[model samples]
Target chain A: MNAPATATAQRKTQAMHKNLQAGICFWSFLMPALAGLVLFMAIPMVWGFLLSLSHAQNTIHPGHFIGARNYTDLLTDPEFLNSLWTILVFTLFIVPATFAFSLWLALAVHSIPKGKAFFRTVFFIPTAVSYAAASLIARMSFFSGTASGFANHLVGLFGMQPVQWIGTASPPWYWLVLVSVRLWLQVGFYMIIFLAALQEIPRSLYEAAALDGATGGWTVLRFITLPQLRNASVSILLLNLIAAFQAFDEFYNILGGSGSSGGNIGLARPPLVYIYNVALSSQDFGRGAAGGFIITALIVLFTLVQGRLLGFGSKEGR
Target chain B: MATPMLTTPVTRRQMLKTFVFAGGALLSGCARSDYIDGKLVLTQWYHQYGEKGTFQAVHRYAREYTRVNPHIIVKVVWIPGDYGTKLATALLTPDGPDVFESTLTQAMVEAGQTAPLNDLFTSQDLADFNPRDIALNSVNGKIYGVKMIDDLGLLYYRKSMLQSAGMQPPATLDELMTLAAKLTTPQRKGLFLGNDGGITAMLNVLPWSAGADFLVNSQIVFNTPRTVLAYQKLQQLNQGGSLLMGAASDWWDPSAFTSGQAAMQWCGMWAYPAIARAVGSDLGAVIWPPLDAQGVPVTFLGGWTAMVNANRPHVEEAKKFLQWQWIQNRAIQTDWCVGYGFHVPPRLSLARTTPKLQQPVPAYAVNMLGKYGKATPPLWNAAMGSDLTNAVTNIVKLGQPAAQQVAAAADMCNRELQRELE
Candidate 1:
């Protein structure tokens, strides 16, 4: 009985010693990342939140506490309101389009038996291009309003006159330029994601579906492939929606001119651009911070609603 | 298995140690650069200039200064793209440059970002400097910046193109319209004010040329009948299809004129050398032609001034460097203004003495600038400038009537000015 009791005591002590070692290892692994997260992300977020509450006019530092005034002013500001609306319109148009285009491209690449890797690489190459570089190419070469621009040259081939792509205001050609560049730059990334999800889909499912008369292309895609990609689709949709709403670079480089004074907040001014102008250009940091929070809240609300409709993050099936 | 597990831990520990050492070395490296004993390091910033040899010239000047003063190091930071916004943001931080060059705006002055240079300049210095340039950089009768160079913004036309079109350089708004129409061809447009439908460069000068000023007696007077007429004329120019809608660059650049994209271009005098190189002796400049024979042709004076940051840790050292570089050293000043780009020296004595100023094309521009040059008012801040620009956009691009846009802009600008004053 004494031997058994001593052995049990020794086992308990060893277990506690093991637990202590595990804890140290866990913290050691997490320390570097956790320190960076706190220093860079957490602190700035808190500082920015405080700035949103104050009357910080010219500087980033918080001034007199003027709670809710910046937020309230945004409700009536025409430029800010227009910017919000512009982003909404842009997201509405871009998200679904990107979804359809990327999915279609993914489907095409997956079905191709020959040179599948080659085609995949070709489609994904644009994801490596920087947004600023892409926007400049769009501005200076492709969608330039001049007769020599690639878009104009393309239109000329169709027997249509050279269109003023960036300069024209009536028909809103800037939207076309903005949307096309974003799609060209981003579609490849989403397509690769969809392709990975497609590859993960079991071959047996298609065989089973084929037995059930799902032989046609549309039938296979509709009855088998899409339902299987629900998780990836949701993620891509959310990311695309958020990115579309936060658009700045292409619009800024193409439509809004560059200067220390900032560019014109004309047509296609997204919420981020408006906030940037308010904070950096006008030096009204309080209002800018408030606008930033409002936009974040909007994005959150949109994601929540989208999730609810799509039943994402719900544990119903398993 | 025991040996492998033991080796993994040892390797991980070695990796962690390496990271820690590397981080400490980096931190020490960053700290050591600015903390040298008994030496004051002054960081001076200049906006990116398009003129050739500008970067090298500024570096040479800084090097010359450090050679003379061993105890102080003048580190010149050349900022590219969006200098005003970047500088404003930097000035808020403790690590901002000690000295910089920029236009003195009302917002900058009110924010207490600029250090007053009253003690630096005496009565004789004030008298010798161009009074207008000095006045532009002063707030409440205290000078804030020393002028480095005076830039002239006006119309630069191809002389051969104008002559071929049977047009002498336009002397009035009416003549400019006729000349523009006559110069239009299948390949090239008549005039390119800017890519943004001429609102960027021509907006301020148009109203000013019509005897409408941004502020008269500290009250907004930009919405006068004359200004409305000027806007209407601009609208007509846009509607007439003679204005170049898009170019490779903006009105501030000479690219459109040099590339033969437009017969005439609105640009700054800094591009004169480039324009002269591209178009040869065919380049001729004129101020924004007057609204009528009764009015005067106008050239907007767009220049940069060197100022010491009030929030800097080494304001005195920075000021001393600025004085030594641009004020006392006449040779460096001449090189800065004339070596890289064609700019009028802000000092009356220097402008008169520079041999380059005696050249025909530069002489013409200098003479015109002296005669019809205008400085933006102290009351006309960036916000006000943006408001006026928006008004111009509505009138010219969106086809909104001038009177309503002008009135709305005037009201907004006046409210901002009042708020700023309070």
Candidate 2:
């Protein structure tokens, strides 16, 4: 072989050897997580899809495959329909409320000249609280239906009669409990995310806007601040939307009867809760899997529609 | 960067990859059952009872059993939080409990998770148990579970409240309604049948109280005109602004009654000791009053049962332990029922002779169990129960027409029954 060719061959072999070594290292690092994902998530998900087509109930064994039957049955199932409606209603209110509230808090916190870190930590503290504990606190102290409840006691100061916040079906004051506890538990995390995104916005943009006769805070926020936050807001909105749809812990813990008997969850039985009851309580794994896939499809569809409507990935303005 | 570095063929990456796979395999393998001292180990699962001493008692029983049968070591798994769901999920796995305590239903039998215990029971032992319990636990005449206790559920009312309101214990739903309104004061509400507004526990009892059955020979019959009328009456209670709603705990806990939040509560006999300690003789219980003239008052009988997992490797040993614990060990059974929580011994002989049960209140409960106690129908599974709850919620809480809601729920339940039949 010629000298240049020999050197080229040697370098090519070296590159190949280097690439192979890098590949091995990458695989070594990735394999553990990949295997876990396949075992715990991917495999079960595929099994669940199979289960959705079956008449299988309690047992993991897919006894019989009655294709499309569980899905069709779910379409007519009143409990499933009610749960879907409940989650849809919940998501509609919660997503917007959380987005606006978190954005407002982020803006307010970001604008603070001093003790910003302290306030940020204070606001973010609730994110660390488990949904179960927060729901319990809401039920036991704040929105308790008794006359001695915190909310009731506050209302009594204005000569208002004690309200049955949770138990009353007429007004559905339990919504306040469910919505407020969720907001308290999740708002902080979303707020921090918004705050981080806000900090990344160039200071020059705000200065230029201020110099260009945009003196009012509202005007600056309306034109620049919100538009700049599009990406972060979309992310937060999508996350909140998905999270709201999957709401179970707060509703289940607060409204669901004490953990003695498997709680009497009424009025606010979301789709996840309904699926859990079907899968776990009734041991109807087929129906549960079918409902789960329906919910997954719903979420994906909503996210896609939202992305398209908002031009989420487009860089038209940015 | 050099040719020698590449050509030397470093194997660290490969070794690391191998290590990761090996570690995962090792960790996963540890989950399999282990033998100690070459003894066959059997794991039994039990739901965490709210009653004190239940954990210790269960562990002690397991230890005692192990001591007697040295060849087999019994491991007691105290499962808390969603025990039913957990047990059901666990039963799907090979490593699931050998024996577990839960309400024995035809679903368990149909699912083939539970082994029939008829072979373990003597005819005399079968005769000793409450026939209603055996029938409820049986599917197609093959008994699947051994009854551990018979929990009596009825209405607990405060004597002072009743006396102040000038009311004898109510005999019918109408009278109870009137008494509720009259007994309700600024400090206390008239009744609390759980925060679900009597939809959770009392809904099933109401239909029976109204002289209606949930299912009669594979036919849904809970939506009769009488049941509709009875539910409508219950709707009045929900709308009447007299119920103590949204207590800290549910109806299962005696706190609502003990704290005087409710003058009367629908609760089980398990709360007797706690109520006595808190209220001191102020508590009195009665069977849920009838709905109309044709109806008779009813009390609910609910309790756990022991069954060997049909899938367990040690099914025969599990069944032997069940027979030993629940059948032969009458003292253990009595202690389990009455020692910690006030449960009526399923054995009529033990119930008759047990000292704690012969007390005034307990004796009254025992009498009610004999006279009015009804085991839930075998057809009334969890799914059907949830459907009935929805019907009650519709009829009572939402003020939906009783006939329509009950009919809809009953239709759904009948469909479920048909599915189960299939």
Candidate 3:
């Protein structure tokens, strides 16, 4: 009986030692990434929140605490409100447009049996281009206000006079330039995502649908293909929505002044650009930080609502 | 068989020792090689100027500084884009430059970003520098920056275009509009304020030309009938189908004017060399015409100023560097102003003595600048400027009511001013 009891005690000690080893292994794997997240992301977020509450002008450090004044000020300010409206309009335009175009490209590419890789690479090439470079191309070459611009040249061929594509705000023709540039830059990325999802849809579904007397083009697409792509479609919509709200590079490069002292055109100023101007250009860090948080909350609220409606991450979504 | 060497289990102490050795090696490899035994290292920052040779000029100045003071080394950092925003961000950090060049704003002074340079200049030195530049850099009886160069903005028109059109250079806003209309042709538009129309350069020009001051004794004063009338006239000009809308370049560049896309361009003195090279004898410079009889012709005085960072550890050394580079060293100042591009020296004495200023085109520009040039008020901060710029855009492009827009802008400016005062 004594020998048996001693053996049980030895087994228990070995089990405890194995558990200790496992814990150390887990922590060793996790510590670097965890430290990075805490240092770079978590610390800045908390510091930014505190900065939003203070009157930090021309400085990033928190100054006198004026609770909620910056928030109230931004909420009431017409320019800030207008920026919100501008971003909403941008979202309304960009999200559905990118989704539809990307989906269309994905379907087109998937149906092609020959040179599939070629077409896919061709469509995906724009994804590699930087937004700033693309914006410059769009502004200086394609949609320039000059008569020699590509768009103006095309219009001139039709016997229409050259229209000032970017300079005039009365007709807001700049939206066409802004939308097209963003679409060109982003559509390829979303198309690749959709292509991956399209491959995941089993070949058996199309066969099964056809066996059930479903027609080839419209019926098969509507019933099997559409349902299969729901997860990807929802994801792309959310991503596009968030990206639209964060629009800065194209608008800034195309419409903003050339140098540091240059100002962006007020017509299509989105929220991020407005906040940047407030914080960096105006040197009002408190207002800028407050605006940043407001925008963050807005993005979060939008993402949640969108997720709920689309059932994102749900078992049904999968 | 014994355990393979590769399969051996390492103890925690051995692992820590390995990490320690690796860290020491990595750190030693990363150590800076530029360090000397007792030399003080100074960093100076400059915004990239668009003209050719400016980069080389600034680097040469840094090399020269080291030669003058053997114990000190000056590192010149040429910031390429978005300079103001980058400088503002850098100024908040501990490793910011010891000396930098920028326009002095009230917010910078309020944040204690720039050191007062009263001791760097003698009374004679103060008198020699342009008074307008001194006023622009002063706040609360303290001078915070020494002007490095003075850039004067004016109208550049093609003499041949105007002569062929049988028109003199416009003497009034009305005449300017009429001349623009007369010069418009099938191939070219008449004027180019900027690529985005007239919002960038004309922001201050319109107000000052209309006999309206942005501020008077810290009171908002731009919201007046004259200013509204000026906007109305500018709106009319923009709508007249004569002002060049889409150009290859903005107004700051002489490309549109020299390329004959526009007959008249609103630009600065820096464009003189390029315009001379392109248009030769056809280039003519004039002040922006007054709005009405009650107003005055306007040219804006804009340039870079050298300031020592107050928060840096080498504040005294930085101040001395600025003094040596911009103040005491007249030869370097002249080279910096005239060698790369055409700019008026901030020192009046230099401007008078420089042979380049006596040239016909540059002398005319100097004369016009002396008569009508106005520096932006230090109190007219970026936020206030944005409000006015928005007002201008709305009135000119969108056809909004000028009076209402100016009034709204005034309200916003008042609020910003109140914050500054607090």
Candidate 4:
């Protein structure tokens, strides 16, 4: 009996030693990434929150603490409110348009039996282009208000007047320029995501639908493909929504100009641009930081609402 | 599967130690490279000027400074785009430039970003500089910067276009509007303020031309009826479909006027060289016209000013460099002002003596500046400027009521002024 008890005790010690080794390995692997997150992200976030409450003008360090005043000021200010409205309008336009275009491209690519890789690569090429570079192309080449611009030239061919694509605010033609550039820059990335999800749908599922006399392509697509793509569609929508909220580079490059001569054009200004003008241009860091936090909260609330409406993480969603 | 080779396992402690050692080595290497044996390194920044030889000229100036002071090496940083924003952000950090060129904004002074430079100039030297330029660089009776060059904003019109249309250089707001409308053609618009229309450059011009000031004794004063009327006239001109909108180049480039996209453009005297190169003997300039009989012709004076960074360790050294380069070096100043691009020297003595500025267009610009040039008030901060810009954009582009927009802007400016006071 004493020998058996000693053997059991030795086994327990060995198990304990193995667990200790495992714990060390786990922490050793995670510490670097965790340290980086704490240093770069978590610390800055806490500091930014602190800054949002203070009058931090022309300086990053917090000054006089003025609790929620910055937030309240932004809420009441017409320009800030207008920026919020502009972002909302932008998201409404960009999310649906990008979703549909990407999904269509993915479907078209998936249906192609030959040269599928070539077409995929061709469509994906734009995803590699920077937004600022694309905005320059859009502003200077495609939608320039001059008669020589591609859009103007196209309109001239139809005997239509050359429209001030970026300058005019009445018809808000700047929206067309902003949306087209963003779509061109981002659609390919979302298309690749949809393509992966599309390929993951089992061939047997389509076959089973066809066997049920759903021989029409639309019927098969509606019954099997659409339902199968729900998860991907929701995820893409979420990503697009987030991206739309964070729209800055294109609007800034195209509308804000070099920031040396003219100030912001005061049209099509998203939240980021407004914050940038307030914080950097106007040197009102307190309002800028507060605006940033408010925008973040808005994005979170929007994502939550969208996820709930779409059944994002429920079993049926998959 | 391939055979595994025996290797020593690494522990977290060992990894941390290695990282710390590597980091130390890298830091030491950087420090050794940065520290020249017995030389004092000073960094100076300048915004990228859009001229052919301006880049080389600035570097040449830096080289000349080093020659004058062999032990002190000056590093020239040519900031290309968004210089203001970049400079503002950099000024917050310890590693920012020791000396830089920018407008002396109230925020910069309020934040203690600029050092008082009263000691750099004597009474005679201060008297020699343009009084307006001196006033522009001063805050609460303390000088913070020395003017590098003065850029005069005025109207540049195609002589042939105006002649063919049987129009004279406009002297009043109505005449200018009429000339612009009459000069409009299928290939060209009447005027070009900028690519995004005229609100940016014309913001101050409108108020000044209407016999209004942005601030008077640190109080908001740009919401008068005459200013409202000026804004309305500007809106009408923008909507008249004659102002060139969204050109490939902005008003500053002179390409719009040279390419015949606009018959008249609101631009600065800096573009005189480019304009002469493109359209020799066919370019003419005038001050931006006033609103009515009561108002006066207006020219907005803008320029870069060199200031020493107050937060840096080498503040005294930076001040010494600025004094030597901008205040003491007359030949370098002349070359910088006129050699690359045409700019009126900020010093009255220099402007009077510079032969290049004695020519026809430059002389006229100098005269206009002497007569009608208005320097932006030191109290008019960026926040106030932004409010005014927004007001202009809304009134002109979105068809918002001019009076209402001006009032709103005035209210915002008052708030900003109040904050500054506090």
Candidate 5:
């Protein structure tokens, strides 16, 4: 602080030298991680981009370089468009419902006076169980088209009609089955995150609000709780969004080709399922790869859009 | 694959000095033709059959095959899910299986994945097998694999239900509807048609039976009054109120028929085992309902055939196995079928003459066996089974009209056919 301007100017070069020296000091520690990121993530990102632009996969055969044709076809294709709407509707249905349920559960557990940990664990056991297993069980529970499954048994107990949960419109019932299983298996993990975020807010803010007149519902939520939860909500939103897009394994297992006589309840044919149908079922790798790349792009774009809207990855958040 | 790990990654300078040492080691290993080692292996992949007895065949053949050849060992893999993709992928690699089994198809034969057996077997010998079974293996007069079995889809039913209703199995779409209506009630719906390729498959088969070819010169002529009749009747059978409950009913086990939940089921002969297992005694199968005026029953008969891999190290040895499968294979067929319990031998001679198919399942299903038998309709892939199933399911589940759905579905079939064939 006592150094003169001319001396400060001279010392700045030495300061720059020190910054370089510090970076060099950390070089060995950071090099492997950096190299890994480049070799795996960065390289694959470019490769996927290249694949998205082309129409070939898993073979040496040359593919058409119809730059954005795949994307355009995806945008225009009726089935693809229907799937987009289906996914968008699914995200809308599941995301808010899941967020609301998880948040409610989290707040309930947060407010629980005794044995909150046990309650949390109990609530999360379904989450810990693989969604595939849960969905299979869930499918059985709903499979009471003729007084066989739990749903029909329960309905019969109450003198109510047995309903077909998955035997509806093609695209609709499929997603309906998917979202139900998805939300059941997912809401708990999000609840835990929200609960942790809820706990992170200082008690002083609440106490101050109580002391003042800002204890109204909206005031407390807007001023204190939401402000506190800004980070967790963004993270959960991004995670859930990406998960919704990349959802394959559960759907693949549940609504697979191995149904009772390979029936019409083909619910799992999401983008990945469709891709599998194309590549494996029809032996059209180019088409499947195109679908995969489209899904990946949708995921990335949706993630970024959600992040940008939530002020995530921004300087202010940091 | 394991030997590469034995060598160290040395610098080029060091490698120049150690070249002789590495070369000497490679030469020694290469020269070792250790005949006594139990390492000469043949790999085969098959879909899991009853209690995996088909898998047991691999071990049984290995041990018993010693009477013929003592130097061979076999490894069998029950390809987990979607055998088509796994087989196709494996065939592409240089280190693929030595022998495998798959349903032969003209397109698949054309796809070049199936190895042509024209050099091995004479045409006259192959023609002796059922034409339908051979149709799958033949592409441009070249055979790709041996016909392992002859399977035909038939309607398995509770004879008691049809008797109680005072109606026999119908021969046309009209009689089926009347019978379906008679059997329908809130407590017990008539049948489980299921949503598989049957929706489209029936269209292909019945039309052929009715003298309506679904396609001519590669263009679809699938739509017709009889086809529409099939569609309408399909709708009526699937209608919500009295008959079929909903699309989900399709997935209820066909064994439910013996349990008496479903009065009837349309399924493959493969289901006989499960039905036999479920029922205390042998079950029954009727020919696909509503036979044509001449009483001709049509169905899709198909099966998987054993194939020798082109890249197999023991291709010649594998061919010997294939040849052995045909040599007095009738007894092996009966043994395998009876041993598996649910299966009847695919050979016409064995199925008819042997007591297995004729052993009085309840007035002798073997009587119905020939009556029910029909060639498999040409199919590109089995997924059509699911897609058509979905279409019918969609009609029932979504409350869409059955005839229109059938029409749209026939159109979809045409599209998919064009998609594949082109």
Candidate 6:
């Protein structure tokens, strides 16, 4: 009891020294990234946020402030609400599917004992492809309205009336095509992470458990795989959630085209797409910035929730 | 792969080389005074489809201009298709482009990025450009751009298809619809009326036949009974099931006509080359169907413009480039139009007397452009009657009632009018 206070002080000094070291390291690492973060991310973000409180156009060099008028106007906009609803629906479907599919792929590849390297390579290869390339292929295959697409070809082979994928009242079916492509593009990356975690699991624990009669699939999975993957699962879910929330590039290229060509039906217009339309196309930067910031805030909030749930990176005052 | 873009052996050599080579000649490029005489550095901004050739042309033209006068060194900046974001960045900057072509919207005028070109262009230049193009260049009676290229609504179809159908191009909307129905088959459709909301604004011309403007004299014209009827007529054609709605809607290769899927498409002259590519020498073009009453043939005109950067050190040189490229260099204009397959010409002579614009098939499109072509209306924000006629697409997406969407489109126009006017 006499030494406890002294010990605590000693711990405090050690912690302070370590924290200072960490602080120095963090800044050193961040300095390089700071330029990019400020120029590409921070300035644009703040500028966009400022723009939201204005009456502006595409060529408006300097617009006047109108306060919260843009947000208020967005609140009144039916199309805006509808676009939000569409994005919410897209997220609800896509995020879960991505996790389950990635996990399954990881499990499949991990269980392969002899050719683990080969399977890992095969599985992770697709992660290199961008969403834009995948989307183009998907659009050509399923979303295309004419028989020029693969879905129509398959449907024709089966002797059915050709169903419209992208050009219909229920475009969610076409939305699935986009989501599935996103999953295909992302699963490999998460699978690799899961594989790493799986490899890190103690072999002795499994052997000891097997000897103690904890030999079945569910038992092994619950005691070994799932427990081991807590960190990886959390990391993947948080990273992927951020990705899903900011789903823009795929939606933009698929809908808006490479340059300023033209739009078809715009079947998969996510929130980003709608907001971009508000900002650039319609030249209302204020609403666009507001929408983008709101999306960022939502992503951060969800990441916090994920961190609380999964205990990623930090193991302190939760 | 977290590997370096360069290999290990050559990394040091490459680094030193880049360090030595970079910004050296480029330094010389920027070493000169940013301003020459009273002429300041002026940046001109515009979007181009075929950029590489224009880059070479402008660069050569700049060098020539500098050699002759040595006053301004216009830095010809090429901004690709992502013009909106980049242009926004430039506009937000303190030393952004002084003059650039822009869509005539209140946002542009209010931003102060664009100064009125009404004063820049002389009365003669204005007269030569036409009143409607003048209008598109203006926002609230102030012209901020020199309407670079003029576009107008024109009727383009397969001449072979029209001939086989045993009919001439329809002179009235009703006859046009009849001809469309006659031409449609299971393998192909009568026309491709499914381009997002693009053709939506053309509702002005249709309603104009009934003596209605796109917007009212000062508001959106879609809610007018005539525009509604036009929508209804379009809906009827859709209901007759003449379209394969799910086909890839890439307008660049307009699938309908390219794949033998569409008999006709209503478009501006801009689509001429693309149409020619689609049909492979079977393209036929004509002006928009004339009204039965026949007051005057009308079509919407659009084109790119060159804006001078007032802050550029090479303002005189840049102005010389703009003059040579836009005014004096007919050969450049001809080359640009022909190279990018641009249908409209900056100058009048390029289309008629020039061999380049005298394409055998699209003579009708050229004729329409020359004779009855007009630019987008000056007060087009609240005045023109076009509603981007394809609002049915969004309606189809949300499963909203078609009537609701029709009304919503009208509301969109009215809202834009109110916002811009305010």
RMSD of each: 4.2, 3.3, 3.0, 3.3, 7.7, 8.5
Q: Name the lDDT value of residue B204 in candidate 2.
A: 69
What digit string (tens of lDDT, one per residue) describes model 5 on residues A12-37?
98899767656754764686699789
Candidate 6 Cα deviation (angstroms), residue B335: 4.8
Better of 2 and 4 by DockQ: 4
Stretches of candidate 3 exceeding 4 Å from the true structure: A1-24, A259-264, B1-38
Q: Candidate 2 clashing pairs?
A: none
TM-score of each candidate structure, all chains considered together: 0.90, 0.94, 0.94, 0.94, 0.80, 0.78
Candidate 2 lDDT over B1-422, as tens digits, reads: 35575456658766868688988999889676646889888888899888888999999999999889988888899987779889888888877888888987677788888998888878899899888888888889898988898997878888888898788999998899898889787667888888878777777688779888787787877878988887887888889988888788888888888888888888999888888778777777888998889998898888888889998777888889888999999879988988888999999899888998887889999988989887666667888877777777777767778899888988889888887889
Candidate 1: pairs in clash: none
Per-candidate iRMS values, in order, are 2.4, 2.2, 2.1, 2.0, 5.4, 5.2
lDDT of candidate 6 over A1-318, digit per residue (tens):
879999999999999977876675576578668967898988876677677787765543336788887787776766557566767777777777878888888888878668888988887888898887787776655666565567877877888655556534443465656677787788888888888888898999889889989977889998777877777787788888778877877666655543322333245566777676666656666667777776677777878987777777775324
lDDT of 3 by residue, B290-401 (tens): 9888889999888899999998877989899999999999999999999878999999999988998897889988887778888767887998888787788778877889
Give the alpha carbon lDDT tens digit for every residue of A1-318 in model 1: 699999999999999977876776798789889989998999988888899988775677786787887788677655577778888888999999999999999999999889999999999999999888898898888877667889888998898766767755677787788899999999999999999999999999999998887788888888788889988998899898888888988877877654422223465578887787778877778878998899999999999999888888976342
How do all the candidates rank in terms of lDDT, highest first? 4, 3, 2, 1, 6, 5
For every prediction, compared with the true complex, DockQ reads: 0.42, 0.54, 0.58, 0.60, 0.24, 0.31
TM-score of 5: 0.80
Candidate lDDT (C-alpha), each: 0.81, 0.84, 0.86, 0.87, 0.61, 0.62
Candidate 3 chain A — worst ten consecutive residues by lDDT sum?
A257-266
Candidate 1 total steric clashes: 0
Could you tell which candidate, 1 or 2, scores higher by DockQ? 2
